[model samples]
Target: MRVTVNGESLELSESTTLLDYLIRRNLNPAVLVVEYNGKILHRDHWSQIQIGDGDTLEILSFVGGG
Candidate 1:
């Protein structure tokens, strides 16, 4: 299956969840906000939300600096 991560195209196995995909791409979920198909996914819900074909994902990581 093919999916896009942060605007990059990637091929992954079927039934891949958002949380699994983030791990595979070395993305840290703790500090990042994940949006799937225009809807924001709660950190706790990533494990339950599966990424299907043609889904557009936007991952934004928070930076704390003052």
Candidate 2:
């Protein structure tokens, strides 16, 4: 399956939940917000949402520096 992550195209061997994808990329769910297919998904739904082929995902990670 193919999906776009932050404007980069990637091919995944199998379907996976949003949480799994984040984990695979070494991302911390606690510090990031995800926009799936144009909709901002709540953190509570990340573990249950399945990523499908041709889907678009935008992952924005928070940075704190002051």
Candidate 3:
């Protein structure tokens, strides 16, 4: 399966849950906001949402600064 993340194309072996993907990439879901196919996804649904072929995801991580 293929998906695009932050405008970059990637190949995935199979459909995966959003949380799984984030964890695999060493991302902390608590500090990030995700947009799926143009819609903002709530953090509560990350574990339940499935990412499949051709899906587009825009992940924005929150950074703390002075």
Candidate 4:
């Protein structure tokens, strides 16, 4: 299946959880926020949320600055 991630296109497996995808990309859930298909998805639901075809995701990671 194909999905749009952070404005880019990617081909993923037929079935995979959101958490798995994040891990594959080395994204830390604790310091990042995922906008799944236009809605802000909670971290608690990442494991259960299935990433379907054409799904849009905006992964925003936080940075510490002083």
Ranking by lDDT: 2, 3, 4, 1
For all candidates in order, the CA lDDT equals: 0.86, 0.98, 0.96, 0.93
Writing each residue's lDDT as its tens digit, candidate 1 over 1-66 gives 787878999777787888988898798889999889989978899999988988889999999999
Q: Estimate each model's TM-score.
A: 0.81, 0.97, 0.97, 0.93
Kindly list the per-residue Cα lDDT of model 2 for residues 19-41, writing each as its tens digit: 99999999999999999999999
lDDT (tens digit, per residue) of candidate 4 on 1-66 = 999999999988677999999998888899999999999998999999999998999999999999
Alpha-carbon error at 2 in model 3, in Å? 0.6
Q: Which candidate is the best by lDDT?
A: 2
Of 3 and 4, which scores higher on lDDT? 3
CA lDDT of 12 in candidate 4?
Answer: 89
Counting only residues 3 or more apart in sequence or on different chains, how many pairs clash (N, Cα, C under 3 Å) in candidate 4?
0
| Deviation (Å) of 41 in candidate 4 | 0.8
Model 1 residue runs over 4 Å out of place are: none
The alpha-carbon RMSD values of the candidates against the true structure, listed in the order shown, are 1.5, 0.5, 0.5, 0.9
Q: Mark the 10 consecutive residues where model 3 has the least summed lDDT.
A: 41-50
lDDT of 3 by residue, 1-66 (tens): 999999999999988999999999999988999999999999999999999899999999999999
